[model samples]
Target chain A: MSELAQALDTLARRRLGGDAATGLARMTAGATQEIWRFMLVKDGAETPLILRRAPGGDRVSESATGLEIEASLMEAAEAAGVPVPHVKWVLTPDDGIGHGFVMAFVEGETLGGRIARGEAFAEARKVLTRQCGEALAAIHRIDPAAFPTLKRVTPLEFVTQYRDGYLASNWPRPVFDLAFRWLLDRCPPPPENPRLVHGDFRNGNIMVGPDGLRAVLDWELAHVADPMEDMGWICANSWRFGVEDKPVGGFGLREELWAGYEAAGGEKVDPERALFWEVFGSLRWGVMCCGMANSFRTADPSVERAVIARRTSETEIDLLRLLAA
Target chain B: MQDQPTPSEILGAVARFLKEVVVAETKGATSFNVRVAANALEMMRRQLDTAPAAEAAELASLKALLGIENEDEGGDLATLNAELARRLGAGELDLKTPGVADHLWATTLAKLSVDQPTYWGYRAALAERAAPTET
Candidate 1:
C-alpha cells in the first residue's frame, strides 16, 4: 500500500467507525491542489470523504495555507450554517500523509462544464445559483474576529498583492503588466466592514445536489476581506464556462444573486465596485494562468493545465477591453 | 507557403511527439513528475505554435501603430520581448482611443480564435458598453 493509503487506514481506524477503502478518481479541475475521493465503510454503511493534498512538485512557498487551517475553516463554516462537508480529520506533517485533510465525501455534481451545460442539473442550476449567493453571504457574514487563526488581508490589496507577486515571478507577459497598471490606477478602497471571504468561490468550486447546494468546497484560498470579493469572483467571466451570457456561473442572472444576498440580510453591493472587482478578478486569474504557464515551462508540464493557462490570455484581453471601456 | 522548419516549429514537433508517446508511459509514475513532464510538453508546443507568430505580430503592430519605418534588429526572443515591453511602457499604444477599439478587437480576435463565440460575445458586450447612452 502507498504511504498515503496506509496513513489513511490508520486515520480511519482512529476516527471513522469502519475500514477505509481508497479509490483514486481524477477531479477535472483544481490546478494548484490534488483532490482524491476516499471511501470509508463501517458497519455496512459507506461514507464518502475528500482528501485534498498539496502539490507534489517544486515548492513555490513554504507558507502555503496548511491543510489544518483549511479543515478548521470548513468546520467553522459548516457550523455557521454554510453548506460545507464535515471535517473528519486533519493530517499533519508528522502524520506521513503529506499535508492533506480528510472531510466527509460530498456527493454531488461538481464539474462546472456539466453544470453550465445544464446536462444533469438543469432545474438544480437555477436554484443552486441563488443558493450559491446565499451561501456566499453566509460565509461573508462570518465574523473575522472570531476566527483569529485565519489570515487577514484587505480585499482591495488582494489585487495589488496578486499583481506584484506575478510581476516578481518575471513571466513573459506584457499584458499582465498592463493589467496590473490598470488595476493599480483604479484600485477601490477595501470594504468599510471586512468579513470572511472565500478567495476562490465560484460555480466550479461548489458542489450541487438535487436538493440544491451540497457544499461550498475548496477553502484552500479562503481569507478574510470584503464580501464583494467573493461576489466579483463568482461573476468573473472565466467561471462562466463558455456561457458568458448567463453571468452567475452560466446558471442565473446577477440580479437574482443580489436578490438572494439581500434576502439573506447581506449588505447591498455597489454595481460599480462589483464591476471593478470583477475586472480585478479576471486580471488576477490571468496572472495566475501566467504563473501556471511558467510552472509548465519550469517544473511540471501537464497539457491540461497548460492549455487552461494559455486560454487565460483571452481572459486578460477581455478584462483589458473592459477596463479600457 | 512551403518553408523549412523554424526553431519554434522544430520545438513544437518534438513536444507533440512527446505528448503522443512519452506522456502516456509516464502516467503511472510519481504524479509530480508526470504533471511536470506533461506541462513542459504543452508549454513547448505552445511556444512552437505561438512564439514566432506573437513576436512577429507584436513587432508589426507596434511599428505600424507608432508609424516607425525602421526594420526591427532584435534577433533573440528575450531582446524582442524586452523591446516590446519597452515600447508598450512608453505609452505608444492607447487602447482607449476611437480606432484603438477596433485594433483591440482585431488583436483579441487574432490571439483568441475569431471562431470562438465567447470572443464575439465579449466584443458585442464592449460595443454595447461603448455605445452612446439614450436620454
Candidate 2:
C-alpha cells in the first residue's frame, strides 16, 4: 500500500474506531497538491471524504498557506456564513499522512471555461455575480484580528512584491516595465479598515451548482488586505474567459456585483480602487507568467508551464488597453 | 535559399495535424497537451512571419527614443530593450518624455498583431482607432 493509503487507513481507524477506511484512491494532480478521495465504512454506511495535502512528504514546503491554517480559515469562513466544505479532520505527524486536511467532497463545476461557456450553467449564471459579490462581502467581513497568523499586506507592499518578482524573473519585457512604472505612480492609499482578502478569488476557484454558487475553494492565498482587492480580482479581464461583455467573472456587470456587496453590508465599493486593482491583477498575472517560465527553466520542465510563458504577451496587450486612456 | 516548404508553412502543417488529428484521438490531459502544443506551433508560425519586421521597427524606435547612435554599439533589440526597461524602472523615461508613449503603443500593437490579433483588447483598440471622429 502507498504511504498515503496506510496513513489514511490508520487515521480513519482512530477517528471512526470500528468503521475503517475501505478504499483510498488518488483523485486529481492539482496545480499545487495531490487530492485523494476515500470512503469510510462506518456502521454499514459509506461516507465520501476528500483529502488535500502537499504531495512530497509529511512536511509541507511549497504551499503559501499550511494545511492547518487553511483548515482554520475554512472553519472561520464557514462560521461566518460563507459556503465552504466542512473540514472533517486535519492530518498530523502522528496520523502518518503528510500535512493535509480531509473535508467533505463538494460536487460542482469548478472549470472556469465550462462555467463561462457551458449552456447547462445558463440558469445559474443569471444570479452568480450577485451571489459571488455577497459571498465576497461576507469573506471581507471576517475580522483580520481573528486570524493573527494571516499576512497583513498594504497596497503599496503588494505592488512592490509584484515589482520584485518581475525583476527577479529576469525576462524583461518593455510592456511589463511600463506597467510596473504605471502601477507605482498610481498606487492607492492604504485602506483604514483592511479585511480578509481572498487572494485568488475568481471563476475557477469557485464551485457552481445548477442552483447557484455552492462554495469558494482554494484558500491557499488568503491574507489580510484591502477588501477592494478581492472585488477587483473577480472582475479582472483575465477571469472573463472570453465573455468579454460580462465584466464580473463573465457572469454579470460591476453594478450588480457592487449592489450585492453593499446589500451584504460591505463598505461601498470603490470603482477607482477596483479598476486599479484590476490593472494590478493583470500585471501581476504577466509577472507570474514570466516567473512560471523561469521556474520551468530551473525546475519542472512541464509543457504546460512552457505554454503558459507565451501568454505573457496576452497580458501585455491587456495592460495597454487598461493603461492607454 | 531554403526549400519550397518554408519554416512557417511547415509549422502550420504540423499545427493543423495536431489540432485535427491528434486532438481528436486523445482525451483528458493528453488532449489538453495536444491543444497547447498546437497553439504554440501556431504562435511560432505567426512569430516567424512577423517577428523580423516587428523587431526591426522596435529596435529603430528604441534607438530614436533613447538617442543612441551607432558609435555606442547598443542598437540590437534585446540590449536596447533591456536598457530601456532599466531606464523606465529607474524613472529615466516617463509618459511626458517625447515619443515614449508612441513607441510603447506602436511596439505593443505590433506584438499583439502577431501574438493575438483576435484578443478582445487588441480588437477593441483597433476599433477605437478606426472609429469615426466626433462631429
Give the DockQ (2 decimals) of all models: 0.21, 0.60
Say which candidate scores most in TM-score.
Answer: 2
lDDT by residue for model 1 over A123-142, one digit each (tens)?
78768777887888888777
Every candidate's fraction of true contacts kept comes to: 0.10, 0.62
User: What is chain B's TM-score across the candidates, in the order shown?
Assistant: 0.43, 0.88
Could you tell me every candidate's TM-score relative to the true structure? 0.78, 0.92
- Candidate 2, A83-195: lDDT as tens digits: 99999888777777778898988889999988887898999999999998899988988878988888889999999999898888776688788888887887888889989
Candidate 1 residues lying further than 4 Å off, grouped into runs, are A1-3, A19-34, A55-63, A92-98, A169-178, B1-58, B64-93, B114-135
Worst 10 residues of 2 chain B by lDDT: B69-78
